[model samples]
Target: MYLVMRKCDDGFRWLETDLGLDNLDLFVADGVLVGHLAWWSAPQRANVSTGDGAISCETSEIFPSRGICREKTKRGVAPSSPDCAMANLPHGGVLKDLYLRDAHKKDALAEEALRLPAVVLTERQLCDLELILNGGFSPLEGFLNQKDYESVVQSIHLSNGLIWSIPINLDVSSEQIVALGIKTGARIALRDPRDDIPLSILTVEDVYRPNKAKEAELVFGANDPAHPAVSYLHNQTKEFYVGGNVEAIRSPSHYDYVSNRYTPTELRSHFKKLDWTRVVAFQTRNPMHRAHRELTVRAARARKAHLLIHPVVGMTKPGDIDHYTRVRVYQALMPKYPNGMAELSLLPLAMRMGGPREAIWHALIRKNHGVTHFIIGRDHAGPGKNSQGKDFYGPYEAQELVEKYKDEIGVEIVPFQMVTYCPDSDEYMPIDEVPKGTTTLDISGTELRRRLRLGLPIPAWFSYPEVVAVLRQAYPPRLQQGFTVFITGLHASGKNSVAHALQVSLNQQGTRPVSLLLGETIRSELSSELGFSKRERDINVQRIAFVAGELTKAGAAVVASMVAPYEEAREQARSTVEKFGGFYLVHVATPLEECEKHDREGIYKRARAGKISGFTGIDDPYEVPKRPNLVVDWSKQSVSQIVHEVVLMLEQDGYLGSS
Candidate 1:
């Protein structure tokens, strides 16, 4: 389900899903509750209001496009001329939030009054819905049904023949569908998985399992999980896809950078109000450096267009710079742009990282925002590495594809020439434009990341000091503050012993507070009531992760030892703990025979005699970690030996001092 919700020139949008909830509430999508709104708790709000108050949202997944219908539209130009299209090219179909906001105003309390049965959303689904509602994914009124899904996957075009690369489908597990008792005609409420407050209502149309191999081969050009999108496909994505039209109650709520977030309609109006007739958009998911500045400025000057520094605030590649850090960098670099030459805005578009096709998709989106041109760079939106340790797309592949579809895409494609700073001249120039034998300075993204991790200086020639400062703040040196030592193994695998020994060893260092969440202790203290059902087990693991994460965030060293048998559960724990600091996963890969031999309590004997059901080592599977930071077999090595190795790991990673 895709719905309409976005920040605008006027107000905040929130669809209240429950009467039991107060002013400030959380969002739930895909079993994960994310983001909390303080604005609601605070008296002052962002914009236009219903009778009670202007609702401010704190959302992890923010959404879609808005109002450009009032502006004139022209081919290869801003909508300024008298003979331009009658209704903002209406071909770029977007539902205006203004309409929903107005309608809600008439019935101020209507949204909260109509209580619907809610369906929780995943993070990806939240991103998809936001774009759909905002018209960033224009011409798409809803998630892809079977026809459109197949057409887009097989041909990189929507069923309507529009060149669309990514398939936007609402996937759910068969278990989820059955649990909800969903049917083809059901009208279900879509809520955030973070804190399950409803965001939209979907009238289900089609439920189908897609052709996974075909989708992977055609759309991603690879079927390996090493590709982030492909990994998401196999791991995070569910079995069934639900397609239908959505009635978005409100935009996904966000609590950060409220001023810079604008709807497409708001942007178009801003451009119109400023008489920005020739607008060129530069889309980025990374911090803009001097080279970036040179390239964008040159592109704008060439077309005599105003610059719109539009960066994505939605989901990007997994390990890329966070939006908060990048946004601060953009703000610091704003004054460097020639006054009145550029404006900065955030886009809520979830990139598929489809490279070539994504470039076309991005260009089409800019056109819908009423821009005359878009800057297309090398490997635009490229998903970094394949399993073979090579780029998924050729360096110039995006530019080539966009060039082929430039006219049809409507936005003029501004090719990004490699801009580098010359040491002798002390000026930036396109790589091809430099005189013969001119020395140039450059820092590749990978190199920058490597240097940043080591706290090395990023020279002025490569980036602005302000931008570098922002990056450094976000990515401090590895030797600083906090970390999590997550030890996972079979039920009787000496993980508890290792955890206690590690805690003692860390304490001996006399550095930071060390917390230990050993298995039996946690089971007794935190999860006394929870049984061994899959859901209960996962919950127990998550609780341990939560406690450990909070401690880690507060700059404490935490050692968590758990059975954590499920791969999904372990990954979830790691994701949670790492947000605060370094997460080292140690697998106690001691053999099952060894664990049973060390049982001592006759627990394994009971399981073998069928006195106990669903025993982990006997009936339930223990998914061995494919790649853990350290693996210790207690059957061979002593606890002291394993502890030494773990401390060595900490020393190597700069968590522990070599002294």
Candidate 2:
């Protein structure tokens, strides 16, 4: 008779044995003869085989071997490797003898259950096992009844780093076992159960856990107290501490900006000690500019509040300027601020652009940071659209949302109108303040970037030359440098034609370019798993932007033609390009009637006949440009004529070589 045993971390140990005996006689004292058991005590030392061989025990500091004598002396203790105790077992044949003492033969027959090795279980499985073990069912009975025992065992082995046993009849090779382990999410350590010999090893899978501290260190400097996220967390913890929120005591150390220590709670607390009667927090994604400075200074002076210039230092919308670069810009402009009246702090927050919801969240967070008042600019907390490709909320919606909760949230919401410069007064004024009929400068950040890329000068009154220079230095060259041309208009507005025409002209001019026709190309190119909803449209636009940014970065000009009607989607596209190259807003201004007449694709016809829902210009709203760099009237101009004008515009903007 032969018995099989598994190798343990210490050495070879008995697991499931094939030794046979009658149940009643095996339990009776001195009643029956059990089968011969030839198992290696230390798998590393002995070889198991049908043929006889002399076994020798060799002990060394480096590697120890087990023999019959050692096994007899160390009855149940497993052999240990010099390094790791859980060293894998060796494979191949080993020889040993099974002997039973004459006086203990009956006891050995009754103690057959003790020969089984303990099985390791995972948390979930352990819970199941406990249920069974606590008078629910016998272990052997439960094991036989279980349907998912193998999968459960595999899960346990994978999570807690345990070895598994393969049946001898399976004829499975070490490589096959390893493959199975990997497929089952368990790591494989190749070794023979009979001998502690290692062959190969592999890890099962990668686990992802968010490392907040490491993220903080990377975004903020290793020890920066002024990091807005750190400061906000610290201030929050301190305020909570006064309220006897014991959880605040467990707050982690902040990345200190000043003393360069991992812990900046002391510095943050010191900054909070200032007795500020009125605290005004300025929220911005971009660095300080002349207009921003004017706004903050004026607001501070008017309310007699201490200005807290808080800039978001977290993951912003893709293609927006990097927070680090923005921070450096702020540092450069700090000296220009009035002393004692202004204070600067970094706030690390992932902006959801929830528009109204975001505004409310921002105010609540500021309240936690001990801010009494917050500046709610146009389009606060605004993520552009809903699932239907419609503007979910307006620019003022965020302000109103915050205002609705202000009294309950304990934060004052100050709404600021859009600020623009008055060339006549040589002073900054809100858009409403300017005379009704007076032509507004009307340039947007997108247009500003486009002009800057074209080597055009931005007005000194709108932005400081120094600041503009910094921006130019940070951004790539516009025009000749590959950038995104976002064309937006109604269906049948010649968006695709204009894009193709631009592409053909660019290619003829020896420029490699790619044209992204949203409806025709992108819709089909995206995975079928994506649904056709407003959210899906937004995602499609984002995907297009990402691809365009990639192409632009690789020096290929991109002509992206999409009906990106919503302001937020367009803004996201503009931002994505601004990160790497310039972004141009080309509004294909074709009249609704003209677009309907040119509905060669029959889309507008279908839309008007109630065959289509949420069609732009028919049912859905197309956000007309608040400000576009170049407006092409597709209704009047032919595709060729439009292409020619665009090329000339590009040439004048320095996007193309001199013709």
Worst 10 residues of 1 by lDDT: 27-36
> Which residue segments of model 2 deviate by more than 4 Å?
1-270, 273-277, 385-390, 431-442, 479-579, 582-654
For residues 73-157, what per-residue lDDT tens digits would candidate 2 score against the true structure?
Answer: 3122112211111111111001100121112243442243133221222222222222122211111111211122232223211
How far is each candidate from the true structure, as Cα RMSD in Å? 11.4, 24.2
Q: What is the TM-score of each candidate against the true structure?
A: 0.78, 0.40
Question: What's the lDDT for all of these models?
Answer: 0.74, 0.51
**Candidate with best lDDT:** 1
Q: Give me the runs in candidate 1 sitting further than 4 Å from their true place.
A: 1-115, 173-186, 192-198, 204-208, 489-494, 532-539, 564-580, 587-626, 631-641
TM-score quality measure for candidate 2: 0.40
Tens-digit lDDT track of model 1 for 337-393: 999999998888777898888888888777766688889888899998888899999
